[model samples]
Target: MEWKTTSALSNQAIRTVGRIVEGSHDITIFSNTRAHPLSAQVAGIDIGRRTLTLRVFCPAGNIGDYLSDGLVSFDLEKINRDDPPLLLCFEKVQATCERIHSSLFEVRCTLADTLLITIKPGGVRVPFVLGMSASVSLDVYTGLTISARLCNLSVGGCMLEVPLEDSMPLTIHQQLPNIYIQFPNGEGLRSKGSIRNMRPFGRARHVAVGIRFIDLDRDMRQRLLYFITESEAELARRMGMENRRAGISPLFLVSPHDKKPANSNKRRNKLPPMAHAIKEVARQQHIILHCLKNERPFPEDMLYDSADTLLHLAESDRHQFLYALRYLSEEAAWVRHSVRVAALLGDVLPTQPGLVDDAREAVAGILLHAMGKPLLLSEHLPSLDTHLTASQRNLLKHHVEALRRQLHKVGWSPGPVLNRIVGDINERLDGSGYPAGKRAEALSELVRTASIIKIVDTLTHARNGRPALSPLDAYRWVYGNDGYDKKCLTRYVRRYGLYPVGSLVKYTGGFLAWVMELDREGSPRQVRVVKNLAFQDSKLDTVLADQDIQQIGKLEEVVDPANFQL
Candidate 1:
């Protein structure tokens, strides 16, 4: 529907508004252009147009970041008692602004395009910016009340531009252990709340804090309503009275570091088309991993598209695509594993120069080679070592087939050779490997590429959930394994050293570093020091400058972090 010209609010919109006023619920804004959600509260409702004016929040983006963005395209979300659910998504949202206080801006939102409606009740939202006179007490129940002035207020919550006078330990999501809000009329309201967001109000000046009120009792609600409605006129006058002060509305509270003109264009983040498509695939891949880890039902279409994205990426720009995958959700253990295996293959392929041109397809196959294992429950998995359980052995044999099904579900085939490689990682020369235990002559030469992945997989997941083995121990375990190709393993060790890239190692001074590369002698020529046993608690996650490396001589043992005492 054309939200701008629509004369009346839809019944669903009207109900959402009523709920906002009844208890002052909160709303969340999902802006396409912004990385963070704009938490807001409802300021007023239009019963006639089914439209609501929102007071955008400034809790994180520094009051400067919020105002300069001047409203982004976003879908507004809230929850109500309905069968399907309520969601009001807009193609674009426009805004007009006015200064409500020295640190707060009062803005109203309008739809830039027709609204898109969907039935999916998930989260609630409301917009509120404050220009009011109130004494705020936080954590009141604990006898520690923070004296703060209100900058913006909504029925569901309020934004306080707190001065840096008292450096109380404030953190996001920290509960207002207790609150007592004192109004101008000697009326008061006490409520429970938690920090929704916080941002710098200005450089070395004050901070903006967003507090979402919880469990508003009838008495507290009435007092809040009375103060909001009764003082509306004075608030408007205050906003309108001073021309010079009002002139600063567009000044946008800026940071000390970023001093730019108001009209300066926004920083661009739109990726190139090819990069954009790869990004989408990487994003979906991360989500798919999350679903698999949590055992949620994986969407067939999303999975299929993600596969297509990975395959499309293989044609060119493969390095860029791999880099994007490396940065996915820092905690993505599986993504890290995939990159390690890909890098291992990258190191080995040089030994076999003939495979260099086909490296892209090789990398693609290696990435998805082990994709089938994660799809099974732990109870159904077989032990890879000596005491193999029946289920474990069975899983090992058909794991390639399982991967094949996943590829089919995405309507993707990893090319003929790549398809075989994905399933053939388990097949060995001596016919000991399961599923299709083709003898050496029967196995295609492509098995050499998958061998590198197999070797690295053991190192990456040495002890499973336990601390991984040292680089030396990991190499020893897989070096003479019958299934692996000896030449590939030898080349890998020579290039990456016993400790390969991404391996954590200890040094002569009890410090820990991740080995980045090796010199001619295979000593760690470069390392990123992550733990300093000497200082114990100095700086961490740092790289030793090349000039400083000469000062530290010799190397220590390769130790598992779980056994290391810091």
Candidate 2:
């Protein structure tokens, strides 16, 4: 084959190559003949080295034969059909190939020449905001399953937002043998396709993969068309409403100088330190929980990273950790509960001299242990006041196995110690717990500690319709229970006191205060009064000694923070 050569690429061609590399779009590489062209995707482009790295697909296992001569030819075509044909081309360019897996090869070649080409665009894609989820399985040989969200849909193809960690092994044009999409309304669509493009999305936390459906039957195409039409109409309706609300018109425009600066400090001032920390932690946990619920692989890296953050917060200020729990939102209830349990464990476990290593595993395990509960039950678990049927109870019990199977599917071994902690958290000493009903003798120390913390948090928090127990009452409930380890309970009480650091309490004089500091014996040493006798907003910091408590009034009662909108 003969090709035209150029000393340099035009600015337009340079921009096109950059887009191709960033988008990981497919390109064609020819070895000796155009008929034997190898399809490849741009992995990277090195402007300094003038080299292009391509991940070439070789289903026939003949890439070595094609690249034996260490030379190849390829072309970069125009991104849009309206543009001039052929952006760049190369002939007999020096190249090398290395096998990545069974049918994938990474090929690097130097850029040499230029040509021009044209391309056509695809059908209109309807983006979704309804939180549709997808399960994608690669070819049977790879046995890799990817959990993704539908970004947009069309008759011929769709775009998927895959978790960035899960997209690491995927290459452009890689065959996805199976894709199952589940809509919020219980509708499901199945198809087979190959990836056409991949690019970073949403702060580089996820990758958007463009997939072209192959051989859709009439019924599937009709359904897809119907969905797209409905989605488009809905989108148009929303846009129209927003425009009307803003009184949008070509005749009316706002001057930049007339606009007021945003009050960025307003929110910061309104939210308390505990509330701010809860919001930050909630944002991180949302991603982790989303992955788990979608049956995606356990994000161990993200889990540990979040664990470190939670542990640091717990260690640096036990008050902040406990106080943050009071601000948990009803959204992502599982995540909220798990995080609370983890934070509590982070504070309590470190004080033990011998259990330092176990503390890390225990905190991480607590964060993810109830992962299957959200999938099995509602996002907000039924309150203790709600009576569950035997079937429902059984279903809840099965979450342990559900979580274990999810981990197994991704071939994730959370190590024996962490595994044991996650697996045995719900087990009881009296053989009352489900999923093997292991007795106290079989449970490890870490598991025992985890069980105690889980119960304490569960009881201390208000759920769907149940009232939250005061910290003292919650501790008393656990102390009365036979399933928990007494030694762990003793240590827990000693560390947190009858009224924990974050406990809201009413004094004899009708003053409402939050416990801020506790002495070695677990007595409150300092308190922040937030309400006066009239129940009005007030702030008064006071240091308390044993004599002060007797002189004023003892803490009349431990109150629920939620009751005061704390």
Candidate 3:
């Protein structure tokens, strides 16, 4: 989003704490500190065959302390200070001198053995256990019954050394009934488990498979804590496992839904004001883009959170308003570019009555637009090859039909504007667009708007690398005769201007400052002169937003290299 400057303020630090205040647009000064620094503390202990050493450090405290001992336990005393204090604890122990049983060490598996496993239906890989801890539920598909032991497990999928009968096909609806595993203490984590996987082991006598809890409710998850804790303790006892010692890698577990409360002890973390919410929406949009690339379905709760945040931001901060639009576009690849294109195509609406609703529907459409990609290798998205056969294009066109079918199953019914936005984000008014070559009159204004945003988003990524197109350059590109709808484009350009406020720019007069707010004449005012004449000076050192653009008209005409000189 763009900001305008009127120059009444100086050297102001804008800290966006979105989760602190909901709906209200308010900024309060907490301290006059030039820069606010947050701190993190970390501690580590290393255990070798014969000894152990411990150390702790605090960035905020500027303290480095160490203590060492043999098989001794201690507690960390909480330190209170003016600045927020963080605690990080870590430990490492060597394996050479550990008193581990050779039998336990030789938990072996042979070739031709099929291991039983279970997981969420249609999930790709099992969770990787070697990294951070994760919970998985294992269930029986037909009976719809769940195992208490396998219900929610913290272990990486166990290895089974038993051979499976030909009766098990390892298909989507099939299960392998028997698998066994022995923990370090000779206790069985899972014995005679069924169907997570049953593929024959390559050359070894064991088939390594994955299992997830099928009915792991909150209570069940809580119960699994004891198992996890005990497993960690047992592993550590035998292998001298300590912090930094990697766990067994498990297969990736796909959760049934997404969006949990923010993982923290603190509850009631109030939502941030409109401006802050807008930034977060943008951040989540990027995260969505990442999730889609990996074929991971968007989490339901995250979608709602972002949607709510956008609705609030659209009330004010129109310049940043398109961020919500961008969020939707990322969901549907065809419409993925539509929101930015729409925002670039028209002015911020005087009213945003159903903008959020429109955005939500559009996201669903965009997400399904490329569903056929995975069905056909050539069209599988993120496809970058220059050459393609006619068959591949035909295969790609089936995505919309596939999209409709899938959405119907999920009870999604998009309105007309949304339908067009998703359908024609790839279309052109000149009848040169793809998917459908419909012209301007045939498309809804909302759809047209989405298209323009899509184009801008494409251009943003294409032309801009470390440095993006200047506001003027962006406008020039979009407003040209061959560009998007001119009337719509002009309205958008005027409001956002060549360079919106808050952005750092270098003027023709060679002054460096942040654009503060716009004036009646649509000119930028300086917020702070980070440097003047390419060098820092006493006058350019502090924040200055109290000055008006009329006082610095010449400097207002300049545009710095987008991201550079900022």
Give the per-residue lDDT of model 2 (tens digit) for 1-566.
Answer: 32222233223233346654553233666443112346677777776666778898887778865565788766444333222122234446679888999999999876533322111242345544312222344431243456776766677787777655455345566676777776544466788888776543422234557788887899988877666655544433333322223432221233456434333334434667766765555555555544554445456766786678778888777765676565554335566678778888888778777777777778878877856665453313332224556666666778888777767775677877778878888889988876788998999877887788888878987765678898778888888888889889887777777788777888888777777777787767777666665645655566455556554467787887668765
- What stretches of model 1 exceed 4 Å from their correct place? 1-284, 287-330, 377-397, 465-467, 545-547, 561-566
Deviation of model 3 at 474, angstroms: 3.4
For 1-566, candidate 1 gives per-residue lDDT tens digits of 12322222223344444553564234555432233335665676655555556666555434444434555333343323331112233333456666565534555664321121221232112122122355677753233446775654556777665543221245567666577766554456778898876643322123457788898888887766655544433433333332223332211233467432232111112333544454444444444443333233444445444444555554455434433332322223444455456544554554576776565566666656645655442333412222456557566567567666755664555567666667666777778876766777777665765665665665645334445666666677676677667776666667656655445677777678766555577766667777877886575756664556554545776665445442
Taking all chains together, each candidate's TM-score versus the true structure is 0.48, 0.55, 0.43
Q: Name the candidate that leads on lDDT.
A: 2
So what's the TM-score on candidate 1? 0.48
Model 1 error, position 132 (Å): 20
Please identify model 2 stretches exceeding 4 Å from their true place: 1-279, 295-297, 329-331, 377-390, 528-554
lDDT of each: 0.51, 0.63, 0.37
Task: Report the number of backbone clashes for model 3.
Answer: 68
Question: Deviation in angstroms for 170 in model 3?
Answer: 21
Give residue 110's lDDT in candidate 3 (0 to 100): 11
